[model samples]
Target: MLVIGIGFFYLRPIIPFLQSQRAEATTVNKVKAIETLQNSDEFSKKLAAAALKRTAEDVEYDPGYYDIAYPGGDLPANKGVSTDLIVRSYRALGVDLQQLVHEDMSEHFRLYPQLWERKGPDRNIDHRRVPNLQRYFSRFGKVLNNSHSLDDYDIGDVVTWSLPYGAAEQAGSHIGIIVPGPGARSGEKWVVHNIGSGPKWEDKLFDYEIAGHFRFGPIRESMTAAADTKSGATLSN
Candidate 1:
C-alpha cells in the first residue's frame, strides 16, 4: 500500500506537466503572410525575401556546389557570407539575430526526429539527422510540415532540416528556416537553411540533399532580446 501511494504521489505532479507538453505539441498557429514581412523591420524582411530570391531561380542549373551568384542581378559578396546576411537583416529589423541565445532557439524540438519519423512524400530529409535540429525544435513551438497552407505557415517562418551530406552526398546533415510568400499557390515559400555552414536560409534544396524542415514563424520584434546567438565576422544571408 505504501509503495502504491508513493508512486501516485511522485507521478501526480508529472501527469499535469506531461499533459501540458502534449497540448503544446498539437497546437498550430501560423502568422500572416506579407504582413509578417512588412512588420518585421524592413531590413529583416528584405533579407528574408532576398534569401529566397537568391536561390535557383537564377541563371539555370550551374551544376556546382556552393555556386557563387547574386540574385536579381545583385553583385555577389567577396566571400560566401551567409550568416552576415542574416544578422544584418536582423539589425535592419531593429533586432539582433546574434542576440538570440541557444536557449532562445534550443528547446523547440521536444520530440525531435519523432515529428517526421518516416521519409514522407517530401523525400527530402530524415528529420533526425539534421544539425542541431533537436535544439531548434525544442526551443521553438510545434514545427510546421512542408505541405502548403497559408493559415498554417507564413513569411519569416523558420524551418530546420536533417540533411544528407558528405562527398558522395550519402551523409546526413543540415538545418535551416523557411520564408513564405503570398499564398500556397503563389509559389514563393522558400527556405532559410544551412548545411555544414552558418545561419543562412537557402532558396531551394536541390541535388540529393535531404534534411529536416521546421516551419517556424517569425515572432514579434520584442522576442529577439531573448536570442543569445554568437557573433562572427561579416557574412551574407
Candidate 2:
C-alpha cells in the first residue's frame, strides 16, 4: 500500500509537466508542417513576375467607377488601380480574382463590410475594392504577420497598406504583389503596384503602415489537391 501511494504521489505532480511538453511538441510539429507548405511552386512565382513585368509597359492608374460585366470582366488594359495589378497577376496564372471574389462574397455577404449600405454583392466593383480583397484573403488565404522581416514577404505574396486619405468612414487601403527588383535592390524584393502613378515596380514595401499580408492561391478544397501536387504537401488555408 505504501509503495502504491508513493508511486501515485510522484506521478501526479509530473502529469501536468508531461502534458505541457506534449502540447509544445504538437505545436512545433504543426509549425514545421506549415513551413513545408509555405515553400510554394516555382511556376506560380515565375508567372507572377512575368505578369508584373508586363504591367510596366503601359498600365495607367484610373480609379473611376464603371459598370462592367461579371465573372471575367475587367477595366481597359491601359487603365487600372493597385488591385488590378494583383487581379491581372493572378489572372495570368489562370486564377480569376473577379469571379473568385464575387462567388465568395455572394455566399458570405454578411462576412464582408456593409460600408456602402448595399444589401447584396456588387460584382461590378466588389472585386476591385482593396478592403473586400483583404477580407477575402483573410477568410480563405494564409494570413501573414505585418512584421518588418523580409523573409515573411515572398515573391507572389499579396500585401495591403493603409493610405492617409480614404473614401467614406474607412481609411483608404492599397494592395500590391511582391516581385523581383533591379540592380542593387535585386537581392531584396520589390512591390508592383498602381499607387497613383501607374503599375510600376518599386522598393517602397515598408513605406506605408502594412494592414494585411497574405498568400492567396488554392484557398478552397478543390484547389488544395492540385496545389499539393506541386508543393509536395498540403498548405494551410
Candidate 3:
C-alpha cells in the first residue's frame, strides 16, 4: 500500500520569509537591470521601461514642492522626483547604476558623481562641472528657455548649453540629462530632461560640439560586461 501526506501553510509564518525572499529577488533583478542599462542602445526601449519603473519607486517628488516621507522611511519626501528612485528601481529589478557611473565617468561631461550623497533639496554636489551645465538644466523647468513642448522624451539622454561668454564663471552655459531621448523632430530625434520643471518633457537638439544633445548607449567596451552578468540570455549578437 502507498500513502501520501499533505501539508498546509499559514501566510503569517511564511510571510516574513516570503518578504525576505522577495527582497533578495529584487536585488537580483537590480543586478540584471544595471547590466541591461550599461550595454543597451542609448534609445533602447528596454532601458526606458527599466527607468520608468525606477522613477515610480519614490512616492514623492523630493526635489519638487511635494513633501511627504516615503513609507519605508529611507528617503525624504513621499512623491518627490530624484534620480535615486530611478537608480533604486533598477535595484528592485536587480540593477545598480553605480557600476556604470564609476566605470565610465569620462563619458559624461557633467556627471554628478555624488548626487546620491546629498539630501534635503541640496544640489551642492561638486560634480565635474561641465562648462554649460546650467543651460542644460534650465530646459526642463516650468520655464524652459527655448522649449515649445516636451511631449516626447525618455531617460538616459544628455543636454548641453551655450551660456553667454565672460559670464561662464557664474552665469555660464550648462548641460545635463539623466533622462531619455525624445521623439523625432523635423525628421530628427529629440531628447527629454528636466532643466527646472516637469518630468513630462521633450525637445530638439543637434549633434555637434555646442548647444545641446542627447546621448544613450554604451560608451566603452569594458562597461559592456554588465550586459552579460545576467546569464539568462544574450542579445544583439
Worst 10 residues of 2 by lDDT: 226-235
Candidate 1 Cα errors over 4 Å, as ranges = 1-47, 50-91, 102-130, 146-153, 167-172, 180-186, 192-211, 215-237
Best by TM-score: 2
State the displacement of the C-alpha of residue 129, model 3, in Å, after optimal TM-score superposition: 6.8
**Backbone clashes, each candidate:** 43, 0, 44
Q: Please identify model 3 stretches exceeding 4 Å from their true place.
A: 1-43, 49-95, 103-157, 162-188, 204-237
Candidate 2 Cα errors over 4 Å, as ranges: 1-44, 166-171, 219-237
Strongest candidate by lDDT: 2
lDDT of all predictions, in order shown?
0.38, 0.69, 0.36
Residue 63, candidate 2: C-alpha displacement in angstroms? 1.5
My TM-score estimates for the predictions, one after another, are: 0.38, 0.71, 0.31
How well is each residue in 1-237 modelled by candidate 2, as lDDT tens digits?
A: 999999999899899877665433233433332243245566447545544555545876677666665555667777678887777677655566777888888899999987878899987778888889999999888999999899888877889998788621135789888765543334576777778777766678898889999887755433211211121111122
Model 1, 1-237: lDDT tens per residue?
999999999999999877554333111202233345556664435546544433322222111123211111111332223333333334444444333322333343343334444323111122213333334444554555554343554555444333444421124433444565333323455555433343333335333233333433345665554233332332133
